[model samples]
Target: MDAWEPRPVPSVTPETEPFWSAAADGRLLVRECPDCGLVYHYPSALCPDCFADAEWREASGAGTVYSFAVQRHLGYWPEDDLPVVFAYVELKEGPRMVTNVVGCRPEDVEVGIPVEARFVPTDEGGIGVPVFVPTEP
Candidate 1:
């Protein structure tokens, strides 16, 4: 298998700082609205549904693959990392997030497969980024 290329470091803004901080400690977080009980990713100060204040909550880190695509070519990425599996994982807490599915061959990933979150730290002591891997059977 080809080794993955280095991931781009994500920019941490005030809205997403907490989420990244939790990830660095090997934890996943989601924003939930107390009023309507709506859970969401991509940290925000208010809920998308009712515009209520959203609070940060730890996620289960367990999810299922909702959808995916295999990238065979990209001008910037090296050939060794050509076949990266990008997926949307539906979390147990009820929101889907876009992330990479790693730790296995790209061809092996499929919809509905069970997966769990893992954190990969970025270069220069940047925050950890969440990725998924197939759960052990």
Candidate 2:
């Protein structure tokens, strides 16, 4: 395998810090609105629906593939030397997240496929990025 670097780490802001920290510990966290009980992604300080303060909650870490595409080539992802499955996963709790599907062939992925979250090390020190993999039937 070619010795290549991973993608640059994302800058964590105050609002997104908890999500990234939870992911590093092998858990996935999402924002939940205490007022309306709405779950959402891209963790924010306020709910998008009702403009209420959102609380951090642990997610089920299980989701379904809402949509997906395979990237056969990319400059930054040279370490894998294979097609990368980019997908939008709909979490069981409600919100959808943009993540990558791993631990299976790109051809095997499909819409509505069951997947569970996996944490992979990032270029960012002390951080693990969340990805999804196929779940058993």
Candidate 3:
């Protein structure tokens, strides 16, 4: 089998460009509805809840693991990165993202573990990808 290459670089659209820009500057941003005060990811034109116009807001970068899975093998990635823990983290402000849990072992993760966001440069385009790591009490 062929070895894993780098993931595809994300193309920035008008709506998502702000997110990528903020991430490059080491900030995590989420779109928030002014009417309902609901924050969400994957930037959209209208609010998911009230359909009101939303604005970008800085996130606190702190969350708790909602769920996770330890990937022991990859068909398209490098084996050296085995045991990658993929998690759904519920942000303190009110959004959940499917992000990788890094800087720790997969065996150590739990459903409610506290995590803090971190940005890492992507292999494809040097774009900042938001990841999470275990938070120290």
The models' CA-based lDDT, in order, is 0.87, 0.86, 0.82
TM-score, structure 2 vs. true: 0.92
lDDT of 2: 0.86
- Candidate 1: what lDDT? 0.87
lDDT of 2 by residue, 2-103 (tens): 111366576788778888878878899999999999989988989999999999999999999999999998887754556889999999998899998988
Given candidate 2, what's the lDDT at residue 82? Answer: 66
CA shift of 16, model 1, Å:
0.5
**Alpha-carbon TM-score of each model against the true structure:** 0.91, 0.92, 0.88
Q: Candidate 2, which segments miss by more than 4 Å at Cα? A: 1-5
List, residue by residue over 1-110, the lDDT tens digit for candidate 3. Answer: 11113644568788788887777677999999999988898778689999999999999999999999998987765567787888999999878999889889899899
Clashing pairs in 1: none
Off by over 4 Å in 3: 1-5, 123-126
Model 1 — which ten-residue stretch has the worst lDDT? Answer: 1-10
**What local lDDT does model 3 show for residue 82?**
85
